[model samples]
Target: MTEPAGETPIFERIGGAATVDRLVDRFYDRMDSLPEASGIRAMHAPDLGPVREVLKRYLGEWLGGPPLYSAERGHPRLRQRHLHIPIGAAERDAWLLCMQGALEETVADPQLRAGIYDAMARLADWMRNIPEDGRDQAAP
Candidate 1:
């Protein structure tokens, strides 16, 4: 399907479904193997397969390829969906670290990589539910 006003979607620019698949695979691989990511990685199920598929679909739709994610799972209330997990500065940083590596490994275009990383950094920061000082916001 054509994107509105003839602008090519980021998904197409970034090489479509194949690239998206590779990106997600690398992202999870880093999370699974990086010592610095252990804390955040522990938040995931022992088997990464399911989450990997979810991310691929979510990212594909987010990058404007197809609405596969929302079509199957409805709205992606990401923050709400992650509320059960406690995220702070460290968690956000770790997540970004994995994402940065994945982007560098998958996206050859520097400008496109920077844009995607910046947006992802914002999303990661927004997912933080705990303060940098380690205080839980949900606590009194």
Candidate 2:
């Protein structure tokens, strides 16, 4: 069937809720094991189950799938929500690393993957609350 008018939403292009869930699963799994992500990982609870579900909803809606996150959590004041987390340059980069890896594994379109990565990288940086030290370095 011909796609409806306007841009094909990223949500549909990425295969909707099920695909978003898989991406979140991969993201968290990488977070669980990546050394570069250890600092960020420590910020989570011993079990990642709760967070994973929450993120699935958030990402599902964020990528144009459905309004799952807002229906549950209200506006995504991401920076305010993460204010308690000690996000700095390192934490931001670590999060991005997992997200990039997840996107690569899940999204076949290279351009779409790169676009999502870029958006995520920007969002990750915005979550940082700590003042940038001169040494704030990019994620390896």
Candidate 3:
């Protein structure tokens, strides 16, 4: 079905959960390799397996596919979950950069890409937990 303005659902426009999964995979892969992401990357466990799965499930529900993440993990409480992480400006930007790169590589539709990117930017900014003075250094 079409939206009121004749726009397609974001899920269908971006090929649904499969596409979101691919985008998350590519995003983590980029993060795993990029030196700029080392700080945030180090916050994760040594293995990326869980991270990959969690993001896939989260995005699946987030992108209007299925409620995989919320069904299992309950409310995202994204800010609460990220409170332990030292999410300064650099980390936030780095995360957004990796995600942007992945979105660019995985999505072919311009409208879908723009919508996803905008939402992601807002979420990433909201996830920031570090104080402006940057004193917090504890791990996530």
Candidate 4:
């Protein structure tokens, strides 16, 4: 939260929106190619354009940059937004794996990376929506 004087925000340390976009792009690209991500990848729309943009904005706001996502989408009810998806343990782990790989590739600051990873883990857990049957039939 509070950085020493002259220190940058974590958002800036991670290279801000452009860097975040590249990270998200690489993340989706990995999801498309990795066999481990096949199940979760199938849940995404074929076109990743919109998803990429949404993620960029969301990360920008989340990382202490401009409130781009909230400005456009209002409060980010992340749980509500993801409730329709079947995010069981497997799906959650796969998603975190992709994001971790991408963050390692993009963010150089160790502290920033750890902070982001911790937050992502919490958010991913909060997004879980799968029933005991592991089926995703809830409406978004």
Candidate 5:
């Protein structure tokens, strides 16, 4: 919420739209390759085209950049949108793995990257809908 002097926003500090795009690209790339991410990946379509752009726009606004996502899609309602997906601890951790890996490669600032990781981990956890009680997960 409060950025230090000359720090600008997280969005701007990370090079704005271009950086977000690259991060998203790397995130999906990791998901495509990471075995642990297979469950989360199965939640998506065979192609990542539509979700890719949506994530870019969503991250753009989420990091305090332009309101591209809100303008186009109204409120993000992240948890509501993701409730349909079975995002228990494992799924959340897998998602974070891809994102944290992507951030490591894309963001040069270690502190900033850590901050993003911390925030995103919490958000991802909050997206959990199904209980993680060894119950059978719903089909994606």
Candidate 6:
């Protein structure tokens, strides 16, 4: 997508790699502490170090920074990669909750933060593999 000024990327607007790091760290911190995030947290390994790095790389590239994540691991195929996990409406909401908090804590610009959150919410929603209640969800 095109960014403002057609020059600065979202990555640079948000403070580049440093901000990405803080965002991911704060995200995990929230997932680890927020009671609402317990379900999603249970999906992760006891040691979050590896996943932390993976997310950092993923976000870095996603935000228009570097291509580290793609260079190491081809196309993200996010949904396919997470097909094994059972994410429903509640789980998606929980993940968004942690991400929202992290974005609020790390991003200074309100509009920029909201934009990022909107995109993330869409991605998180797409990762849901299980259906909630009476809704029918297509498998990945």
In terms of lDDT, the poorest run of 10 residues in model 4 is 131-140
Compose the digit string of candidate 2's lDDT tens values, residues 27-81. Answer: 9999999999989899999999999999999888878777888999999887878
State the lDDT of candidate 1 residue by residue for 24-102, as single tens digits.
9999999999999999899999999999999999999998888999999999999889888988889999999999999
Which residue pairs in candidate 6 collide?
none
lDDT of 1 at 20: 98
RMSD of 1: 3.3
lDDT for residue 119 in candidate 6, whole number 0-100: 88
Tens-digit lDDT string for candidate 4 (43-109): 9999989998998898887877888999999999888887777788899899999999999989888
lDDT of 3 by residue, 18-80 (tens): 898899999999999999888879889999989899999888777766778999999998788
Steric clash count of candidate 4:
0
- Runs off by more than 4 Å, candidate 5: 1-7, 133-140
TM for candidate 2 is 0.89
TM-score of each: 0.91, 0.89, 0.86, 0.86, 0.89, 0.92
Span of 10 residues, lowest total lDDT, candidate 5 = 131-140
lDDT of every model, 2 decimals:
0.91, 0.84, 0.82, 0.84, 0.87, 0.91
Tens digits of per-residue lDDT, candidate 6, 10-120, equal: 999999999999999999999999999999999999999999999999999999998999999999998889888888899999999999999999999999999999989
Query: What is the lDDT for 58 in model 4?
Result: 86
> What lDDT score goes with residue 43 in model 6?
93
Q: Model 1 TM-score?
A: 0.91
Cα-lDDT of candidate 5: 0.87
Task: Write candidate 5's Cα lDDT for 1-140 as tens digits.
Answer: 23667778999988889999999999999999999999989989999999999999999888888899999999998777876676788888899999999999999999999999888987877677766766534435
Q: Relative to the unseen true structure, what is the C-alpha lDDT of residue 28 in candidate 2, on a scale of 0 to 100? A: 97
- Indicate which candidate wins on TM-score: 6
